[model samples]
Target: MTAELKLALIHSPTEPAQEAAKVLRDRYEWVPIEQATMAVALGGDGFLLQTLHGMLDRRRILPVFGMNLGTVGFLMNEWSPDLLENRIERAKTFTVTPLRMEIVTVDGESVSYPAINEVSLLRETRQTAKLEVLVNDRVVMPELVCDGVLVSTPAGSTAYNLSAQGPILPLDSALIALTPISPFRPRRWRGAILPERTRIMFRVLDPVKRPVSAVADQREVRDVATVAVAIDRASSLTLLFDPEHALDDRITMEQFAV
Candidate 1:
């Protein structure tokens, strides 16, 4: 990085993050978030995701450098109080495009949202959700009886997707994981990996009896009758990481953990 590199430091509202932000502010002069070339996010993975989504919503292309201060910081780097500029200079860049979720409700309301993790459809009632899975306008599964289902990006494979028995995807893999949460029928059926560009559609079999909700990361729409999900390659978010501990390396390490 050049000496003229101006950084915008933003931290979560958590106490630890606020404290660290004070320390950073005392040592370095920061610029406004909108005017800076890059951003320094101080918090956990959740905050990082929030920052990314906010940027995506505004069509801002600011690259983020995340330093973990929260409990779970899988997407964050180890925090340092000293020589922060040098760390960013040595960091690696990783670009990821988010999924666009087009949701339609039973009332005929339609909305679209962007998700960096996975677009999931979950049952709102105690009743099991019955869904018809379609890919590229073709019926793949006529009916899937389960608690929920999700389409996960490579970067989010290890998150809620993993807990739902979804496959873990490599960072650079040009594929997405389509996994069911808990299947009442088709007990033996495992999820499939589709090409990253594939368009996935899920239709609620009985929206009135079995209410279903579609969620794009944090943005959620209730009583969704149909949802179409696809990767939005036109826009992308870039995150920075230390070369020795890049996102690809972290994802690879997750696969070996017991």
Candidate 2:
């Protein structure tokens, strides 16, 4: 086994990425983005999310090395030209599973997708949306009048979930955060930390009066009547990081930072 060190480069179509691509092409034996054991991603957190979405599979583990080229490179490496191959060879690994969202429209149309960050349901119209939330087929909150509701993975606990006054969960913890965007009826309903295996269901109170939209990461479906969410532990994804700067440690440190 010749170590199977095939490298792929995925970059945002930016000036910096173009320059970096040229450098990698000139120096290394790189393959197409679709056929590489390790993928070097260029851009910020958004691009990283897109990359994860593009290459999400359980059996095929593609270690990704991201060099920051966009703003807020929380999931990226510091941009540097030196010791590139060395850094990749010595990189660490982090395994993450995305949440699966099954959304049904008012007309009985159904669509399912995976969410690496979070699955959110928001009001599509001007009227505040009313939702009935359930966990594992049990009615937890009968009437959750709010602008929106979200279920976030531990890896995504820091994104939209945190800004909505949700708790920051540790990455290794097998927990999911069920957070409300802006609750009106349940004013004191803070949030819930459910088991990763639990299935969550959200039913729209009135699709005609309060139209709602459900989003599984970047994929959005409007006029949603009901949405179900679950963690896809069977089909998870893996991400590689610097051993010293592991993603879990970074997320843990983000909370205590001044």
Expressed as tens digits, the lDDT of each residue in 38-147 for candidate 1 is: 99999999999999988887888798999999997999899988888898898999988888999989999999998899999999999999999999999999999999
lDDT by candidate, in order shown: 0.92, 0.86
RMSD of each: 1.1, 1.9
List model 2 lDDT by residue over 1-258, tens digit each: 125888887899889887887887777778876678788888888888888887763345577888889987877778776777888877787778899999889999989889999999999978999999999999999999999999999989988898998988898899999999898888988879999999999999999999999998899999999999999886677677778778888889889866
**By how many angstroms RMSD does model 2 differ from the true structure?**
1.9
What does candidate 2 score on TM?
0.94
Runs of candidate 1 with Cα error greater than 4 angstroms are 1-4
Clashes of each: 0, 0
